[model samples]
Target: MTTNAPRHIISLLMENEAGALSRVAGLFSARGYNIESLTVAATEDPTLSRMTIVTSGSEAVIEQIIKQLNKLIDVVKVLDLNDGKFIERELMLVKVKATGAFREEMKRMCDIFRGRIIDVADGSFTIELTGSGTKLDAFIESLDKAAILETVRTGASGIGRGDRILKV
Candidate 1:
């Protein structure tokens, strides 16, 4: 990761309808920008959706991205979490080989990371963990690479800290 190129967590409140997500994604694709991770779901207001996008770029580039996002018709509100104190988290479900001795080791690893063993089968265990991206990455790194069978992650979801709230 390049420290000079800052990573930004952008949150958006938009119309919950078809093409809304496409337009948001298209804006980045058309400009040749890459989205590191994205997660979207309907908000408390069924008519609105909340989207969290993680991207990295220079200061000017991040400003441009925010500007462009604000111009979209379906976008009701846009917030750059990095602009203020915020809390960010991600959830990951990983399946690892757990046969024989590996089972005991994997269980110990999950306990050490405070991860929950959500599922178990004859040869594997599925664990659920939630935390900052770095902590999640570290947990994965701590395990043997070959022991990992599959993984799924919910991209970063963030909200402003303290009394700051983004609302239309």
Candidate 2:
């Protein structure tokens, strides 16, 4: 029986150092698996950084990715959060061109979506929004008529739902 592949959110705990992220990217590039989203930041401990990556692939390919990551010298741990109950969030910064009609309309949409206008200019405003990808899509769609989308950046982070914590 053939099964449709599912998207997976994988997080990695790795020692903070140069080229670590590049190495991981090299693996994916060589294998030609697209990375949908990637986020990395230093942990509170200062010695480690957390990497959250979203990808789509077959179960076998996913296992291969995990195994390849384990072989990296700087990798400390890898956790597949998709299989577990987890809370996922993504941050997006969007700059939109604004005017009279679209400005108020855009503001209304932002207010409804719980997004905040971070910066304002004579004819434009930069908005800061945080939510899942789907939510971001909706927010962007609402502003599509007014916003030309000068720039955008997105980062994904996830924590296990309930009391479950990914231990080091």
Candidate 3:
């Protein structure tokens, strides 16, 4: 069935052992599903790691993916944040040309976006910004494409709202 499907952020608490991440990624590859973004990091508990995966599919496809994830040996829990209220953020560090007129304009733009100029060079300024993917994209869009020198982004990391926590 063809229908417009929205993106989903699925968070998982899994064993921090080696190869555990590959197994989860393998499942998606074997099924030909696409993962837009993925972030995995060790949690406060040394034994577990939190992984956030972003993907899009129809309702039935997403349901199947969740079921398959729960069956993984390393995956202890999986929560589709879209099922409830959640907060998501992504980090971006962008380096832009800042010389003469562009320098003041760049500083103004960064301030307007609430980003920090983490690094300043004679001809470049590296700005760090954390926000939703859309906000990060907007920041980039607001600048002159030629002014941008480099950009690095950490994919989306998300968590449930109050009373909804993903933990061991």
Q: Using TM-score as the measure, which candidate wins?
A: 3
State the number of backbone clashes in model 1: 0
lDDT of each: 0.93, 0.82, 0.94
Worst 10 residues of 2 by lDDT: 1-10
* Better candidate by lDDT, 2 or 3: 3
Which lDDT tens digits does candidate 1 get at residues 1-168?
254588999999999999999999999999866699999999888999999999998888888899999999999999999999999999999999999999999999999999999999999999999998988999999999999999999989999999879877
Tens-digit lDDT track for model 2 on 14-80?
Answer: 9889998898888889977768888888998788888998887888888888888889899999888
Model 3, position 82: C-alpha lDDT score:
97
111-137 per-residue lDDT for model 3 (tens digits): 999999999999999999999999999
Q: What's the number of clashes in each of the models?
A: 0, 0, 0
Better of 1 and 2 by TM-score: 1
Better of 2 and 3 by TM-score: 3
Per-prediction TM-score to the true structure, in the order listed: 0.96, 0.90, 0.96
TM-score of 3: 0.96
TM-score for candidate 2: 0.90
RMSD in Å for all candidates: 1.6, 2.5, 1.5
- How many angstroms is residue 48 displaced in model 2 relative to the true structure, after the best TM-score fit? 0.5
User: What are the runs in model 1 whose C-alpha is more than 4 Å off?
Assistant: 1-4
* Candidate 3 clash pair list: none
Ranking by lDDT: 3, 1, 2
Number of the top candidate by lDDT?
A: 3
